[model samples]
Target: MPRENSFSDSEGRSLTPDPEDEIHYEEPAAEAASPTYSIRTPWSPTGHTVPHPFSASRRSLHSRAPHPIPGWQNLTPKEKFRITVRRVMAMHRGASILTTGGRVGAEPGVDPRRASADALYSHISQDCVIEVVDYSAVRSSFGRMTNKEFVNFMGDKSASQREPWVKVRWINIGGMSWDVIKAVSIKYNLHPLALEDVFHGHKQNRSKADYYSRHLFLRILCHELGDPDYSPSGHSAAQGSTLTGEPRSMSPEPMRDEDRLNGVKGGDVDEEKTMYGTPPTSRQSTTKRRRNPLLPTNRRDVDGMPKASNSASNLARLLKREGDVKDARKERQVEEVSIEALKQGERVNVKVSPMFLFLFRDGTVISIHPEPDLDFTVPITQRLRSRDTVLRTSADPSLLVHALLDLIVDRSLQVIDEYHTKINKFERRILLKPKMRTVRELHILSGDLILHKRTLEPIKTLIYGLRRYDVDRCAALIDMSDPANANTKVVGFMSHKSKIYLADVFDHMEYILTSLDMFTSISENLIDYTFNLASYEMNEVMRRLTLATIIFLPLTLLTGYFGMNFEAMWSVQNNSDWLFWKIAIPLMIFIIPVFMYSDLTRVFHFIQKKMVTKQAVKQYKRA
Candidate 1:
């Protein structure tokens, strides 16, 4: 087979862009097999053809190249870069669609154009719901958006700038329809890699923070009680910012003009400064807080007990009464309630979901929940509505990020606590009367602890990345313009105020890891105990059986001897009933005492010990 002069369309036309036809719609070999030619994009390095819903093929990026279009070598670098970017996006989109099998295909009876339009952002799930929260110091707006409103809400059709005062715009999607993913992707100019991680990266149980050109792409796995499989692929692009070094959004590409208007809807905006000056209620305050004030304090009382305070200050008498323990007692009570709430909750069916968080410089946060229908951030919504939260007055997205992570960590603690409680029950059962079923359940619980630990371990990296400014590889950005905060340090995704919250999140992560370790240790010990108790019980049973067999052997011998024929057998048989007892009793008494006297004493001791209970077993558990 001889090579032709140049590549050509298998059809009549030449593959080379004729001076007359600089662009062609002919499919490359990779796409020729697909029947959707009309809507299919052409394979041109120049990218002259229409955009398909995804890429031309699912080929690996490193694989051997297909034939490049003629004149490709002469093309300028800029054109080549454009071509490469498009190719990358197309590849990711194609792979994601194939894996998700989203509703990107044309409907049977619908017009191809309409179908394509709908499929353009078709990643949103059928059950998907949209939530948007716009907040600032003075007021906040939180509500839902209709799934069908994407075009008007985020597409090129709606061009408006979000209010500068609306410090952060949080758009959360509970379900995914490929359409929604694309629509939102375009709306926020989400990085292709981020979108890939957001939707297709569920298998990755580890948490990661990738800083791109225009946004922070943070992906973390959350479980009800956890898959620990994680391959961290982290990259931090050095993004230039304005004066004083504020980190800019690291979106993969610049968003379209219309996307600039992404913000919460303005309907019935219940602007609440409703006592926004007051601190949060005790319950809300204690929630997500790692430290338990209920624990013994550092101060010692006159009685040498660790108490809330050792002495009241002179100002305390002026404020109220000296040595007022009421306030401390009330705080302790609140802490107890909050801590209890964290540990005790209705049971949850175990599940692990990857929650994707996209934070932009302008305080726009886009979060995609793994389960499309369930909104795990409902508490965030409620607190955003309440004016009493410091969160309500914040302009930084990092604060919101901290809040969300803290919530997840707290929920994880609750789930872990449940496992702890379950294992404790199994341990107690094994201690008393070990059962096979309990051992099996302990095995499962042990596995769950391992999984949860794996899933949560990566969060350590995530929190560290936030606390340190290393995500962007930039030093802490300080704005000396604010005289008070001039010396304050803003690191990575965390603002100075939010730094405390991030610290709390870090503390919570540590607590979680420690609890998992402790629980896992308990689980292993219980399993060992179960086996030991089972072996001891089996040994005791076998010993009793052997002793009984040995003690009764002599009586069995007497009976056997009498049954055998003998010289006086007829005479003995005639009078044997009484004679048999007299001979059998003496032999039995002698043999039983000689062979089993110790066992009888032991049995009697055991019975007597049971008769007089020394004391009740102390159960160190919640009343």
Candidate 2:
């Protein structure tokens, strides 16, 4: 037996060790065993208890009881799935850590759990201490412990139930229900609109918020199973109420030519009798009336005569009519079956469908469907195969979202490329067209100009998105310096090759702006040219008019002179045809005066030019 150090307490005798002495310890006997506390291990599958750190004799050292690990209880299935996915990703990315040490108490002035969740995540990641807590054991412990005992066990301020340092990454709820979503929204302080958008089946593109926050939301389009023929059946009927257009009934069968003909023929009937009652049948009704044997063999005879020949003809006609009716019914059934089969076959052909959504941190969204993939690697390569598989395996909404964002960025670049191609084609068209000459020619240029303006908006939108969201790409596009001329090796490497590939885009934009400017200038110049040409043409017309007026003025004077029929002139005119010669001679004499007047006009213009030249000289001298 080893020597034991014992001390006497006030209530009873107890063994204690001297602080300065070293003593050998022996195991307690079966009848006198040391007391112990039990703690549930964190990783145990079953709620197994292990001895506490401090023994019963040293229990007074710690006053707090062990607290259980936290678990989610009121979350939806979808939310649970999302949380699980996020946790796995965080772990894979080395962005999170698990820990079991209880939260630290608030220091003199430091706030407990001072950092945000993200900040805490970073800190824990640096330490690389993530502990997996055994939630089942903790739950069992709670059941066994009393409320007062549990409270005392939890400990003080920093160790309170609301310890912020102890973070839970993933939780699971029973299922995805409206109530669960509401509860989650309350717990997480999520936006109502964000919650609404998650449930809404609209495939909108990526939306963004002004800043990154704990409550970021995103929307994505996903393929869901649904009935192929599901449609708004009652909408058409409801639309009929306020309609001022022609009233029509919903009919499965399309109207045939024969049906239209029948309707037209039926329209000729006197509607009054049809609306009123079939004018009470004139023939008396008799239950025992005889039937005509001439109708068919199946028909009874009016008088007891056979009438074999007439009966045969009526039977043939009846048989023919029956055969026609049967054929029509068969044709209708065939058509209906064909139509149903065709509708059923009309599924969303993945090969031809473009399905993608751009996701953003905020809830704004843009969805696009590009042309079918032309690859043989997989059957549905274009339907986001990579992202879809990741989503299926991990059920991680964030990873899926990131994948979609990557796709969206790729699409944005593709769209930019396409736009550049279009712009290049448009520019080539402008360059190919003849230069503006006449108003008619300018009008053609104007038409092309209008097209350029119309296309500019979409290009601007693409550019805006690129500049704001794709800074690197935009910067690369703008790098026009020569690689050989670059001073730094990095810059030289970046600039080594001329952005000839980007030339199409740059040249296209350049040509568009240049062409637009040229077109506008040409248009303005053409207008001015047109005005000048019109003015010159008008001046020429005025000159011609003046010449004609001057020539006619002399002829008119001669005619007036001759027309003044005095008595002497009248006697002379009667004497000889020489009187006509007299008027002609006078008109010929006036031609000299007209020539003189034309010369005088030329002299006047010369004088005006001289006066203008003198004024210009005077102004030049003053300057």
Candidate 3:
């Protein structure tokens, strides 16, 4: 037996036992079965003791009916229920009002610094959709998931920060869903304010580029030609309201040349004459296209942000717009639309939808669109499928970004070409025979061209910002002496090689802008020419009418005088010896020359010049 204080061996097993260690030993069974709360009150008299009600309920400690959250313990049933309801409601709907973002209305003293959705993504609309694509240079994977799976996958990624993995992941979210957004934000530390713009007021967010700790956020409008026969549920944005903030006329078949020539193709319904007592006839109907409220001001990318400036100032603004990490709320408001407008908009072939992109440091490019038109990004995906392509071989995500932008320009170019071809046809026809409807169609086309111009203008600024970022980032990476340079490494999404490639995209944009300018000029000229040609034809008709009146008026007066009832006129009786021709010929020669003053003078001048030439030739021969 060892004493109370004993020496211990240094090896694996200490060969000593002390009586003082756990002087009154307790068994594991006793500890497990111990009462959760002591059977004594802190302020009670020495001998008095009261047992907890929960302790009396059951012998097992785990069987206690306890509130799971610590905060809920002090709350009543109604308050707890209220909190629970708020948490649930928060996920399905946006804040009834805008909130900068914290646990709103409840959870007192909750820190506003950390981005929190008390019920985590309670504001996400149930109908929102998500798609994810993860790829690297060596291998790739694509999957479309429900919000639940997405949430779970993101949670795993967030948890497994220790995974020794490096791959370029591209996650594309098609609709506005805060839960999906929150999941991605957690997976990658996305700035909260940017997330706010993801669904900001449900308005078409302005084109912008903002930098954050982890990624570069870019928001731009993608102008897609909508299906001529397709109709969307709820609300439609296709209206007279164009990206250029101009309204297109309801000219039927603005794009079709033959439609204008053939006059209004009969949609004229033969109905019984009721109110007006006349059958309805084909008449030009005004377009139901009005200004869409969803067509937000061309500035506000985040929360009512102002108009974006030019390249230099815009690049400076990118840094200024980098908002604080934690912020709140989402989703543009759905505008109330009438049935008629929806019908009219069904054929609205031009659509402008918001497109978002997140370029991560690890070469991940996350793109979000409101439409499921995956075919638009086909060029990028096709090239990415082949590992030997420049996009994959380069491993710089900016190339992917460039490809995406270039795709936009390419599509825009297609649209421009279509408009150009139609204009050329119209120009040829208008020159031959001008009409009012032609003018209207030309006007509609002009509006569309302007819309494309304005929508595409931002891309130029966006490219400039990207190029500027590359320059600044390169400078940041080169200088290691400054403390500010610590953050410079986190960025570099745009490398020098990427910038060089982007230059070609810039040129394409320039070409597009120039083409739009030329088209605008051509359209204006065609309009003027139509009016001028019509005016010239009108003047010619008036001149011929006046000449006919002049020629007929004198004959009427002469006949009246010659055939008087008194029978005293010599010419009418027997003295008509070619007098009518003699009198009229001399008068006609004098009067006819009045209208042809310039032609008469030119003929006289030609005769004198011809005589002088003949005289000169005879004089030379005699000499």
- Clashes (backbone N, CA, C under 3 Å), per candidate, total 23, 14, 9
Q: Residues 183-212, candidate 1, lDDT per residue (tens digit)?
A: 576556676556555534533447888777
| Residue 240 local lDDT, model 3 | 22
Clashes of 1: 23
Query: What TM-score, computed on C-alpha atoms, does each candidate reach?
Result: 0.53, 0.25, 0.59
Q: Which candidate is the best by lDDT?
A: 1
Model 1, residue 134: distance off in Å is: 2.3
Error of 2 at 467 (Å): 3.9
Taken over the whole model, the C-alpha lDDT of each candidate is 0.55, 0.32, 0.52
Q: What tens-digit string does per-residue lDDT give for candidate 2 at 1-623?
A: 21121112223322122222211212223211101101112221233332211111111113343223234344446544644453333222221111111122201111111111112111110001111111111121112222222222222224323333222111112112222233233333444344333332122222332111233333322212223343111112122211111111110121222322232345342211211122212111100111101111123321223365443444454446556855987898589556534433222211111132322322222222221112221222232224334323343323333434344333334333433443444345444542233344444444434444443333434423332444343234343486753453221111112122223333344444555556556554655666676777799999888778766776677567766868777535665657666766777666756676767888999999999999999999999
Ranking by TM-score: 3, 1, 2
lDDT of 3 by residue, 1-623 (tens): 32211111222221121213221222234221111101121111223222211111111223333234434455557655644553333222222111212112222221111213212223233433565655566765666776546655665535324223336666766665444555566566666556555644232445778776567888877766656543322135453211111112111101112321122236221112111122212111111111101111123322233345332243234434323211211111123244434334212255567678989877678887755336667677778778788877776777778888878777767766766787787798798888887787777667657766777888888887798765464354455687767565444678778888889888888887899889888988999999998899899999888778767665666666665787476676766737766776677767776866876699999999999999999999999
Off by over 4 Å in 2: 1-441, 457-461, 468-507, 523-535, 570-623
- After best superposition, candidate 2 residue 274: deviation in angstroms? 47
lDDT of 3: 0.52
